[model samples]
Target chain A: MVPLSWYLVVAFMLVGLGAYGMIVKKNLIRILIGAEIMGNGVNLALVAFAVYGGAFSFTAQGLIILVISVAAAHTALALVLMLMYNRRYGTVDLSIVQKEEVA
Target chain B: MNWKVKMMQDLQPVLDLFEQFEFFLIAALVLALAYLALEHKDIVYAVFFFGFMASAVAGFFLLLDAPYIAGMQIAVYTGGISALIIFGVLLLPRAQDSSLETFATGRVRTMGLILSGVIMAISGGLALIFPWPETIPEGVPEQSQSLQGLAEWLWQDHGVYIQIIALIILTTLVGAVALLKMEKAEAMSSITGEFGVEAKPSPEPEAETEVVDTEETSEEAAN
Candidate 1:
């Protein structure tokens, strides 16, 4: 069996990448990408636990599906927000657009 | 050298292969695609690469023995979320001028880099320090047999919560349509000669000045 530590490490690395993306990227869509990365990280952790803990039953599967669906729903909302940002500001940059709004 | 020989002797080939190759391969691929999505200049392509990365991650989930989640990942992420992101990208105006310049500079980037460095350091430290459980616990219920039991529990114990989540998703779809519809109406109002009345008034002032100058010429003709 694959060790739980290995999966945990991969999840951590992915989460770190997501954090980096979220911090470094200024574009609204890019930030959404980072957020998706973070969500993937969480999903990885959940699946890892389910497998490692020997809890890979249907309830666990159902919960994982539920989480995935929720994430998809959230992504939809974020995309809508990105569209609104692009429309109102004519630019996707978080900093420039916010500056314009304040001014 | 001796320890390596003993370890190989004890471990199954499948586990060895997973540890040696597949895990790292998927991890590297996911991280690389995520980096590309964030660093790429074009927002449209970033979204596209993100879709690829999400699907790859779903493959990883399958390897981790979570088939249900793998299906959901592909279905909800690659199919639903990615499609929505692409639609949003298409709806944006094609003009790219000034957008790149707005994001490429300033203190925010510097701060973000610093924060990411700190987070990476912390996560790395945690991974190193935490000792993972070596084996699955004994006497735990077998996963395959528990499937029917889980189904019963889900329906009997958590059915209400599942229904609520379904309702929330439905509401979100409705809300997104309503929001987009309002924006379209607003855009139409702004463009269709209704909101540009101020722009026409400046030309009207110039026309009035011309009319005043032509008034004497018309009077001469009348006389």
Candidate 2:
């Protein structure tokens, strides 16, 4: 059996990559992609913990599904926001929008 | 001798191979695809890589024996979310504003690098240092049994949560409509060219010049 720590290690590494992407990527859509990466890492870690810790309650599984549903909703809303911003400002570059607002 | 049996025999080795190295295989795929998704210059490629990453994550969930969650991951993240993101990418006027002069340069790039590194270091250290439990607890529930129990729990034990989640989803739908909807007047003007300020006349007369011309024409006509 694979050790639980192996899963944890992967989760952490994926999360780190997500954070890196979130910070370094300037495009709003890319930033959202980074967030989705982080969400996947979190889901993996949660399932791993539930399996290994003997806390394999039904609630854990249900909660995981709930999280997935919420993530979908979040992605929808975020996409809408991005579209609105793009329509209004004509740019998705965060810095450019900030500059426009300041001027 | 049957083809199905022969196919199963052929797949058995592949399954065994994956069972042995599933952890490493899925982890590497997830990380590599995630990096490609984030770092790719073309937004379209990044979106495709992200879909691949989501599928890889779903595979990882299947390896963890959470088939239900795995399916959800595939449906929601890999299919729905990826499609939505691609649509958003298409809607944008330009892919990315990565011009030579203004593309993440100087202090911004340095700061991003530094912050991401610091975050990774902190999280990596914590992951290494945490004293994780060594033993997998006995009596872990089987897959089908767990799925049944989860349904029971959702409908009986934690029923309210299901309702709450549904309400939240409904709220998201309504809120999205509200946000995306233009005012009636604005929409009407946009549809019809009557109030279109964006489409100004090519040779618009100056207000002062128009007034002076009308006065001169009146005087000439009166004389």
Q: By summed lDDT, which 10 consecutive residues of candidate 2 chain B come out lowest? A: B189-198
Candidate 1 chain B lowest-lDDT run of ten? B190-199
Best by lDDT: 2
What is the C-alpha local distance difference test score of each model? 0.72, 0.80
TM-score of chain A of each: 0.88, 0.93
Please state the error at residue A78 of candidate 2 in Å.
0.7
lDDT of 1 by residue, B1-223 (tens): 9998888778778667766588778878888888887777777777788889999999788786666567778888888887887776665533223354346456767777778767767876765566645455644544553445656766887797679788979988997887677655776643444224334434467878678769978999999
- Interface-residue RMSD per candidate? 2.8, 2.6
Clash-forming residue pairs, model 2: none
Judged by whole-model lDDT over C-alpha atoms, candidate 2 comes out at 0.80
lDDT (C-alpha) at residue A40 in model 1: 88
